[model samples]
Target: MNVAASGTALKRLRRSARLIVLAPGPRVLMFRYDIPGRDPFWVTAGGECEPGESFEQAARRELFEETGITAEPGEQIARTTPEFVTPEGEPVRADERYFIVRVDSPDIDTSRQTDLEQAWMNEHRWFALDELDDWHEALYPETLRSLIEEHTA
Candidate 1:
């Protein structure tokens, strides 16, 4: 478990679970996000863990909540704890865990998004591995590409 909090002073810890959801085309799912003055970027789908929820459970719930996609969240492939200010300027400490799930192509459903997600997510795309190399500066969990390669290898 990891803890993350954002603010000038870090006090609160938020644990989150993320998914590296992949389709048959070997493409990875990502959300386009824009943070005010910052350039747009991409992120894997996920959200904070609810109280008393295990990481795996949170991963499953987050996937469904964010994309209306359902699948058994497989093994945890990576974990990181990072602290940053949210786009809303709230300081947050995030304990992020990444899980891998593979599925056939499916249409995404976003009607279930939380308000925060509705505001932050601008669009969604399935990215080819080579495309990721060009998106390094715009990818969250910056080590995402290497992590995927490492685990898949």
Candidate 2:
């Protein structure tokens, strides 16, 4: 394990593939993560890539695993630059790539979520593009509105 300057044990670098799922209303689906000791935040469907899995493969798998929806992950859209710690308390430098996926229905099934996901992800909501600005909870990537506008336009 690598040690950071702050004496924190750094886990291996991880590659994450995220999906921005959009429905007929042009709304985006977000999961509310209520991790311990942290305020709730909403994020897209995604997770770390399994061994030897490509970003696209991981995106597809995560989409199914998290939402129970099987759809092809569309084009790459955005990426996050910061190194963040996972909810499991592991410090990781994650190469997070975002993709777009358009679906006909906004319904989601969380029955396939892993134990860790079920524990922390307590709620989910589909937000209209215009409502995101007024949303009280934090949304990851900070640039979500612009990213959606760019893609929709």
Q: Which candidate achieves the best TM-score against the true structure?
A: 2
Question: What is residue 16's positional error in candidate 1, in angstroms?
Answer: 0.2
Q: Give Cα distance to truth, residue 90, candidate 1, Å.
A: 1.6
Model 2, 1-153: lDDT tens per residue?
778899988767889998889987889999999998988899988999999999999999999999999988977888885687789887778889999998998779999999999999999889898878878988876788799889888
lDDT of each: 0.84, 0.89
What is the per-residue lDDT of model 1 for residues 1-153, given as tens digits with 9 covering 90 to 100?
Answer: 233364334446879999998886678899988767877778999988999999999999999999898889988989998887666776777889999888787579989997877887979989888888876548877887788888877
Q: Which regions of candidate 2 deviate over 4 angstroms?
A: 4-11
Candidate 1 structure, TM-score to reference? 0.87
Candidate 2, residue 21: Cα displacement in angstroms equals 0.2
lDDT of 1: 0.84
